[model samples]
Target: MMKEGGCRPRAASPLKWLTQRPTRVTRAWCSGPASPAPADLWSTLKKALFIIGSSTIVFVALRNSLTYHLQHFWGASGDFWQHQWDKILHTYGDNPFTFMVYGTTIVSYVVYWTVGLLYTFVDMTGYPAILKRYKIQPGTNEPVETWKLIKCILWVNFNQIFVGVPFSMACFYLLRLRGWDESRQLPTFHWVIIELIICILMEEIGFYYSHRLFHHRMLYKHFHKMHHEWQSPISITAIYAHPLEHALSNMMPVFLGPLLMGSHVATIWLWVSLALLSTLNAHSGYHLPFFPSPEAHDFHHLKFNQCYGVLGVLDLLHGTDDKFRASKCFSRHLMMLSLVPPREAYPDVLPKGKVIRGKQCYDQPSEDSQ
Candidate 1:
């Protein structure tokens, strides 16, 4: 609120200063509320630190154990290359059951826990305080119910392990049956990059249309409504949705890209992991510096009709975010323009004032001019 090199005199009473923003009930109706204080934030951070420490220890142990098992299975014998070819590529890759188990286990842990734990850490570490400190729009000041948050975590884990993994293996097996497996050429870094770009394009286009469909009057009330319940969502809420919506709107887009591209299995896994991280970041709730801000998607959850796409290109073309762009949520950062010094901002102009005023200097006849 402060202008460049300018200050307002304090209000006479402490109550006047406290009542300046809005009453609690009134603020609940509008998007973008105040943040918590530093002391409250510090308390939350201690809990987050403990969770993070424990998770790290568990993850390290899991990684070491998996590595030892994988090495024993594939590399312990004299011929490492032969063992990898026979057991991993030939046996695991070709068989649907083996592939599904391997895919689900690895993907469930890497993508699910990576995004889930990070979300938990940020949410616990006072993301609301961060949002408030930055004056970001539609900030989530209140806490979510612990039981509901835990339920979201469990559902997402289940979706990844049971639905997502099995579906992926089925797609692969179908492709193999159709001789698509023949095109699974050895992937170089360049091809992998190209595949990733193609995957993003495919996903953006697919998700844009599919997501818009979910916003339809009839569909929204049934399937997509569950996800919209959380306007200011935490990270796990990215994947938390009705099962039908999760499969059709969420998983299908990701699966389609790799299938269309005939990507190697490793490439598909890599893409999915990165895509999960992208979605998680988009729903992270915090406006942390150097991180992707979830303002657009968050606006969608609050406004309920705009910003349906991931990349937002389709939204821009369709003018979906027009109302959102005009709202306080989108314009909060623009308020910082008031902080730019007029002198430096207008370097070509010369001042000819007898006295300086707030944010402006008026031209006046000086002694030299007379």
Candidate 2:
């Protein structure tokens, strides 16, 4: 069981702390080789097909209806965008590689730090009573020292600057050599939508398999353990990982789809921005009103396993999310519609006698209260 502050007892020495094995409690929650048999292949495949089919149908329907309108809008604003593009190309020596490198880097950091700092502020202050009540793992953030947060920030920046940029440069060079286009013309809305859908699917597959692989006994300690240090993660912790894990699991999956498709620099920029925002929200640890619940990923951190995929489809297929599916957090996964605390908004999921705002909700509560 986790201690009061949701942390394990610290080792006497820093080296020991770094090298210590997971406790029995942690092992129990992990989806190692000893876990129960996964769902039958046929059934899992059927579910996957159903999900894909339904999503495709919905997207096609929307595309059919909205494509023309979107195309019209783009056509209307074509000149403005064309001028902007020309200015960018002219200023950047007409080099798509330079444009992509600078543009994506700026956009990614802007979105990451802008949203990350907001969530960090919330964690630090626990302000705006409504947001505080929605804290998934109450009291976990309380013990995080300011120095530790600074270290996390510094490490994340170091990885991005030294590791991420070079990887991106190399990938872009390979892609160009592979005949990837650097067309000056903007892509149609229809093609952009199609490419984005493909990218999302590819990312899901790549991330699911790679993440599960990293959790293997031999690899976890070396490559992925650093990331799990934040069981109750804040937004910035989304990229706080070992450099190898960052390159393989975090960066590779995202770039895989775009690279294969030979996507335009602008499209890549947009995709990276959206992907960064999605991750920031997932790791933000708040189920704020009007936003998708971060409960799935939050539970992943707390338990050290399960909910291993972004869209949950792969987890459902491999039976990795069986425990998560049975948990109260699953029921509470919908986007929240109110500013009220989760304890109030999702009373059914809250254990009886669990304290919320200093009051017990029921007379008898489960010992393992969230």
Candidate 3:
């Protein structure tokens, strides 16, 4: 079976502490059979129009709703100041049940559905035939496993059960017994300060590793592939994952936090907030002016099978980042990706594997491609 293998040299560190160079992957494997297109990118104009338009509507609506609700609850917009207890040194009395339970359920739902409808709307409209564009995802003509999909969705959404709930209740109620009941110290060190930091650190590292492993060929088909079902039209539907992946991907922030004794209410707020917004933006498929676009992960969805770390740092560090120097997933926007010729595009590693069957013949037709 024909195969491809190569490794490019690592560039200088974008981050400060550089003790080791990243080990890059430069091989494409083809399944025993054929697959569809080489790539899965949408038109610049259409992709821009669709994902961006939907985001604006959702952003505005969600912001407005959140504001309206917060005002209804606290007589003003919900921000750090909302937690102020009339005195500067007073505690932040936030209801964990509200934010952790009601708040998340509400936000992920609204934000998710907005994204979902947007994608569906785009698909229904005469948009650039995105699904078929790059043969972007070789979703099986095999009937969608409806039962399995539903099971996965329910299990995936219960992430907080494992991550947020037990840990928050047990550690805060049992180990620390520190609830934000009025006299909660105003953003100062809590009873479980060390655990909070440790939990977040471990979880972040765990998230990074699990994410990378999901891209491994064996795991991708069984678990991670469902998330990539729609290429250019990334929306809220993108959040759900395999029930099996629930332990790995979903409840991480919660479970790891507790194990590390992260039992504070405020710290939990910050982490949860970031998790919500970040996950929404992950499917945005384009970057914001002040933030990395949805394209960061969108790039992952396209010519997938490589580049699996978050915030572009770990992936960049380990040389797993295939966006620029290694893989051609960004072939759709070579102009944006190309800084110079790839002298080591396919450095010889003498890789051993079957022909990366489907990928080579899968990309869109263009002057630069084979």
Best by TM-score: 2
Residue 191 C-alpha lDDT in model 1: 62
lDDT of 1 by residue, 1-370 (tens): 6423343223344543211222223322333433444544455456556765796698677976765675565446546644444566664566544543476448746776776676576555555343434323323524557787888888787777677766666776765665443332345544666688788878888888888878776788998888877766777888788887887889888877777877666676678888888787677665455555566786677667777787665665455665666554453312133333223333222355533221222233346855
Please give me the total number of clashing residue pairs in predicted model 1.
1
Q: After aligning candidate 1 to the native by TM-score, how far in Å is the CA of 295 from where it should be?
A: 1.6
Could you give me the TM-score of model 1 versus the true structure?
0.61
The reply for model 3, stretches above 4 Å from the true place, is 1-183, 188-204, 216-221, 231-233, 253-263, 326-370
Score every model by TM-score. 0.61, 0.81, 0.48
lDDT (Cα, tens digit) per residue for candidate 2, span 1-370: 5555354543344533222233344534443333322335568779989988998799788976678787777667657666777787777776777766766777788889999998888788766555767777666685357987998999899778787788788878878877675888776677888888888888998898888878887899998999998877889999999999998999899998789889988889888888898899999877777887887888788777778888888887766776676666676788877667665666644454655432122222346753
**Total clashing residue pairs per candidate?**
1, 0, 17
lDDT (10s digit) by residue, model 3, range 1-370: 2334332333455441222223343233222332221221222235446665896699777876665565555434434443463442334235555444544445445555555555434433524443322222223212234564455346445654453344344444432443333335434432334454566556656666787667566787998777666444234445566655654665454456653543444455555555555665565443323443344465566556444544444554454444433434344322223322221222222225733322231333346543
Reference-based lDDT, residue 327, model 3: 33
Candidate 2, residue 182: lDDT = 88
Clashing pairs in 2: none
lDDT of 3: 0.46
What local lDDT does model 2 show for residue 308? 80
